[model samples]
Target: MNWQDQYQRWKNDQDLEPQLKEALHNMNENEIEAAFSGTLEFGTGGMRGVLGPGTNRMNVYTVRKAAKGLALYLEEQGMADRGVAVAYDSRYQSREFAVETAKVLGVHGIKTYVFTGVRPTPTLSFAVRHLEAGAGVMITASHNPPEYNGYKVYNEQGAQLPPAQADQMIEQVNTVADELAIAVKDQSEIEAEGLINWIDEAVDEAYLRELKSITYRDDVKRDLSIVFTSLHGTAHNLATRSLAQAGFDHVFAVSEQVEEDPEFSTVKSPNPEEHQAFEYAIAKGQDVDADVLVATDPDADRLGVAAKKADGEYHVLTGNQLGALMLDYKLANMDDVPRNSVMINTIVTSQLGKAVADHYNVTTEHTLTGFKFIAEKIEEYNQSGAHEFVFGYEESYGYLVEDFARDKDAIQSTLLACEMAAYYREQGMTLFDALEQFFERHGYYFEDLHSLKLEGTDGPEQINAIMEDFRFNPVEGAIAVEDYLTGKRTYLESGESVDLNLPASNVVKFWLDDDTWCCLRPSGTEPKMKFYFAVKGETREAADERLKQLKDRVLERL
Candidate 1:
């Protein structure tokens, strides 16, 4: 049947959920088309879409279908008995979705472990490894708006399902033609059947125990005042406790943003990457004259910051700057890093991190975007023992300090950020001051990211057209252009091409002649295109000016 028939069938079904029925009643034809055009496509990070009552939306039926697919995939891999750990954040119906997932997996005779309350996405990764589960599912949309939710899959090793494995799982997901027909066992019966486990304090304690590896400095004076906000997600208790345990006594939580509000009452958007998310935290910091401010997304996987400068002025640190600062701290404070210690980052992240790693004699490796890739690298290194994974970061405020959690962990970064801030404070330096020193040492790396949102039916097509144009005619003065989708890097000067030696992805990056570069990629989870740019110069102003020129050159073509 067509989408209209599907919609009518849903509306005609006697057992249609009341909330979903009301939603269906309110939607117009265009809205229904938006919700029924197609299934929410699952890619590298699984599927994410607006929540509503349609096959294309993130609803119970869709969740059940995804869970059934994952269960089948696990059974095919012979890991079904090992089970899957499930978790959710503070989004609307997140708990219900998690329960539905467990119920579907249980109906397939697969054991499931689910958190009792809201948990961060990273914990799902950790719980999978910690419990020796076959896979994991996290119900979140990262930093997307409240209307959005997502389903993310993780492998047994506690990383997001790599593309190869996800392809197979998606094939299984697609085979289930009718999502509404799949029957799930009752949640209450699953527990009685010994197939469902409710986990909470135990996993939290174990995760916290492993977090000790990230406490870089123990003797730093906690003289620096620190402010942290969870952005109405899941970081409040974890971050504050982690700080207290690390001896950072002076800490304050941005009370307004700490509570779990699905609406994200305090901010327009619950994204930590945006400076606006820190509105409450910044206000509290200014009132208290705090030395630093930290904010984490709702799911507590991404972190953002605003550090107080010398003159009591606060400056928001970009993700690139924060990642570089942490990398500098890791390398600088170490007596001697492990032999062949390696730091990981994405292609679009700032090169400043690589410079710091080089200064400390650590190898730097680049991967396609996403924490899962870095997690896979860590798991690979653990198996091969070729190199020690020291730190992993991205330009989107995702950072991982320990391999315990095979994902970007904001709670871990929150405590470490405080520790780093306090240590620098002992030297009479703020994070902003340390950032300047990094510029002085690493030649002032300037970077910026701009996203163009083209929603509705034509969005994806428009994005594809833009990318096609880039492939044929790139920006001027490109020293080299690396197309990850084709695994080719073309050297414009020599007319030579070589395989990029990375997984195929829809990302095109151009490196310029004067140590400047820009990359273009459509966001996998959101309806948008992102442009990332970086430049280096002897002076900060020169770097900013060069960055603007480089961005303008690329923006004109797009």
Candidate 2:
């Protein structure tokens, strides 16, 4: 049916919400056309969009539709009694969305475990597994600007529903129309029916205990003076308590950002990947004569750090650099750790990680973008007894030291980072100097990321076009181009082909001479096409220069 016809049907339906009808009455033709242009897409991660009064927007009604669909899907699986866990981050309507999800599940006769307040995304993942539930929901837009909010679905293993299963869920979401007609049990009814319960301190204690085991050297955390900031997100309480419990003496929380603020008023953006999020933490570090500064994203899954360098200046380490440092620390301090330990990272992460893993004689695995893929690998290793998973990270600021939560965990990462900083301090060296020493042992590898933001309906098409152009027209002076979507690698010079073992994605990568490579892929959660560049040289300047040139080339194509 045409979108306008669907809009007409919705308007004539008596069960549709009156407020939505009123909003539509004020909309002009173009606005109506945009609102009903298509069904809101549910991706592998789940639904995310701007909050407004449209079929495609994230409002009370749209959220109800998502919840109803999910509840129906669970009922179809014959596992509705297994229950579903729900948690929300500090974003607009997050708490409301959580309640909506719980009520919908309860209406379908499925049990629901809802966190009382905002919590990190990883904690939700852990809750799903801990409760042995059928599914989980996390209401968050992560590091995106304040205008957006998201709903993420998790499967039995506490990983995000992979693409194939997510597609089925999306079909269910599309099958619903009248959001007001969606039936949800009242909160009191749900609670009385024994389908709704609140989770609090017990879950926190269990997760923190699991995180504590990830610390290879808790002794090193004894006397660390660190400045920690949550960037006005959900990590304040747990991160601070974890540090103190791990025996750290002087953990300073940035007072301005400790409280949860949906607007994230302290920073321009809540993304830890950006330097701006660390501004307050950095200043606090200076004032307190701290050794290191750490900041977690709004969801508290990804972490970023700033350390005092040998030159008496502070340098904010990139995600790749921090991963390398942690890998080195874990490997060197592995006296009690098993010899068959393993490391995992996304394919687009810096090759320097691979180099560091190789130096320690540890095996490293590669996965696609999401940390769920890494979690899946950890599950695989645990079952097979193939290798002990030591650490996992992605260049996009996601890292995991243990399989506790089966996702990127800044709470654990923050504790480990401060311990690593203390270890460096004890040796009378800076993190920058340790990076330099690692460079001396291995080679200097510089990595850079470039994103092209394209909003609205045309955005995806533009991203596809750019990817298609690269796949057809190989980069200049490239040795091989790997097209992950097709699962094929075409050698530009040799004219040979190979198969890619990873899961399929609309991503294209080129391997240039001298270990320089560039990759192109669309943002899974945002309207952006991201480019990843990694190059190696003897010095930072030379490597940075090469990366800049390659980035320019990719941007031109984008």
Error of 2 at 218 (Å): 4.0
| Per-residue C-alpha lDDT of model 2 across residues 1-558, encoded as one tens digit per residue | 566876787678776567767877788877777777775667788889876567767877778888888887787777687899999999988998898888887777888899898889889888888889998999999998898999988887788887767877888887886675788788999888888899988888888887777567756636777888888899998888888878887889999999899899989999989988888987888899888889999999999999887676667899999999998898888765577888999879998898998888889898888887888888888999999998899998888876777878898888878888888888888788899988888888998888889987898898888888888988877899988998888898778999988889988889998879998889887889888899998887888788888888777754
lDDT of each: 0.88, 0.85
Candidate 1: Cα lDDT at 161: 85
Off by over 4 Å in 2: 1-31, 336-339
TM-score of each: 0.98, 0.95
Flag clash pairs in model 1.
none
Q: Per-residue lDDT tens digits of candidate 1, residues 13-69?
A: 888789999999999999998788878876678989899999889999888889989
Clashes of each: 0, 0
